[model samples]
Target: MLVAYAWLTLVGFVVQLVPNAGPGALPRTLAWTVLGLGLVQCLLCTGVLHRAIDSYLGTRTVTDARLALPAVLMASMTALTVVLVAIRAVEVGLEVGLGLHGALAPFAVTFGVAVPRRTAALALSGYLAATTAALAAAGLPGADLLAALVVVGLGGLLSVFTGRSSAWYIAVIRELEEARGVQARLAVAEERLRFSRDLHDVMGRNLSAIALKSELAAQLVRRGSETEASVGQMTEVQRIAREAQSEVRAVVRGYRDVDLPTELAGARGILRAAGVDCRTDNGGSQLPAPVQAALGWVVREGATNVLRHADATWCTVWVGTDPAGRSALLVMENDGTRGQAPGGSAGSGLAGLRERLDGVGGTLRVARDGESGTFRLTAEVPLAAGNDATADEAVTDPAGTAGTHGSGTDGKDSAE
Candidate 1:
């Protein structure tokens, strides 16, 4: 209210400098002029002040009946002021016609109407053009309309450019968020590969070793070998068997050792014992320990699954280190379930194997040779730095004997 009063006073003072820009003969007198006019304006302001505050707070909703009354009252007061200004302008012969502020009024009113975005833009542009033409007609100074046109054109262009820039920024942020999602998925895949490789490393060789020793013991018994020799072989076979069982359990529980060669050998023996023809073609002599571990998990899971599910006479397990010595591969194929086994439950072993392989930048592919009655599992392992015999030696402390090999860690084994 104080600010408004100051502004009104300033405008009145400016008008007074122009001759005769005030009301009756009383305003013409030096004694009664400024003081009387100021008192009248202050008294008139009291009624408008509370209404202005009420408008700001939106006390009356747009559709409320009370809104019409306040709006009417404000309009009447505004008209009266405008009439007084016009009478003074005429009496004083001052050039007090509409200016920049008047030109902006229509656009402000359109915004109050809450027009749609495109409509608002068109309305603003049209209002500016019309106002410019009116000013031109009113004899605004030489070439000033051209200057006004330039200003209007720049304002419109700025609005458009700023809007487009804001939209582009939002799009870029969305793309970055999507990229982060993809990266997360890739990380999950890599973890699964690592787990698969670890499982192969732990169980494969241990099982294979047990199977071979068991077969050897059986052969010695058939040949009528000495009891001590047969007993020794059986003891070793039982030990390996125990280790293989532990490795299997550990893998299923998502933990396993990092021994590559031992796992491969064990896998071969386990598959062989389960009556599947098993083979390990390479030891990955130059592949990194990480790569070896990944391949080992593949072999372990493959062989374990074969033993548990492949109701077949033969299964074959193969391990190959890359010729360039940069990677390792483990492949297991079984001639099992000529037709679907039971209701065609492939078992959790293959699923678990796939997960483990995906963890270490590795991949596992499973397919059935429809005509050959063969199911195949293949894995690929990429080498990493510091992957040598020394690293292997460093990691091979047999610290994970219980957890990785799956010796059950339970007090007793259930009879098979």
Candidate 2:
């Protein structure tokens, strides 16, 4: 509203500068006074009309009084300004001619730059153009016709600019919506993978045990000494069922633990299944429970990245205990040919891996070898001798013995 008043004041100042108004104190005073009053009324009408329009648009119910009040006020204000300007133009002793360009300027500010609707806004422009043509044909000389032509040309330019701005707005909105959609799909995919992992963990062990017990029961039944044996097998089956149910609940609650060796084995299977040769080295025995757990998460994230991002043909995984003190290193390297990364997004997966390891007083590193096109992920975790008892047990067991041994292998692992 204040802006509208400012514009009105500027318009009045311009009108007073028009040539050939006969020198008279009374006429000059009347013209200035009427112009000031018109400006003030224009501001008041603008405020009232603006509030009334907002109310009408904001509500579902509309009353006749709401519509009529603003209409009457705006009409009266516009009429007063027009009458005063017309009288002043006549008083200047020049034929009173309304220039279309000047008359349409306010509407252009509103309908073109402010509201910016296409069909309706352009319709308003057309009305302004037609009215200007009519007024240009009245009273004054060639100047009015020229002014009318200029107004129409400017209106066309305004429509183009406004329409272009609208198009750009729509393009930006569409891009945002697409990004939201992609995020939603990714969320759903993650949930599905979580559910599948849970289901596998819950059912795999128990189902295998159940099958073995049933086979033993069948053998006893065939031998006809089945009474006690069958009972024991049935008891074992029930026990396995209960264990499976407990595991299901635990997995649903996100409490399943991953042993480092188990995760390493899983990574081997996944890489091999993807037609990638899997080479693994763990310098003798299991890692400390805490270090192993952290490394397990690293292996998990690494395998996921390999499957989703790296199109690998050969992969190597290495895990080792720190000799000087308490720390373990886990490394997974894949010979994946990288033409280009999708979306050109630097690895956010690796960033998350780093953050996770950092929480456990560990660190992760991801590097790509350009020549070989191999991507390597490494995780370093702290551990203590007492914490690595499971690894010690695995080393004592001949069946569990695999990979190279000790600090000497650490140098080889580093080369990975």
Deviation (Å) of 156 in candidate 1: 1.8
Off by over 4 Å in 1: 1-144, 216-231, 241-408, 411-416
Question: Candidate 1 on 314-398: residue-level lDDT in tens?
Answer: 7666676658866567777778858763346556776776676666666777777767777877787666433543364354323
- Residue 411 in candidate 1, Cα distance off native in Å: 7.9
Instruction: List clashing residue pairs in candidate 2.
Output: 286-391
Best by lDDT: 2
lDDT tens per residue, model 2, 1-416: 32353255336332543332335664455445444444544454344434433332343333445434433432343333334344444322122222222233333333332232564356555655654444444433456445545544564455335433543454565666566568659978998898898789779878999999988988888889958979899878876765665455446535435577888888898668656798888762555565676777788778877767677888889888656756787778887746654234447877877776776678877677676677777788776533554565465332333232321223422332
Q: TM-score, each model?
A: 0.31, 0.39
RMSD of each: 24.1, 15.2
* Candidate 2 global lDDT: 0.56
Q: What is the lDDT of residue 205 in candidate 1?
A: 88
User: Backbone collision count in every prediction?
Assistant: 43, 1
lDDT of 2 at 85: 40
Against the unseen true structure, what C-alpha lDDT does each candidate score?
0.52, 0.56
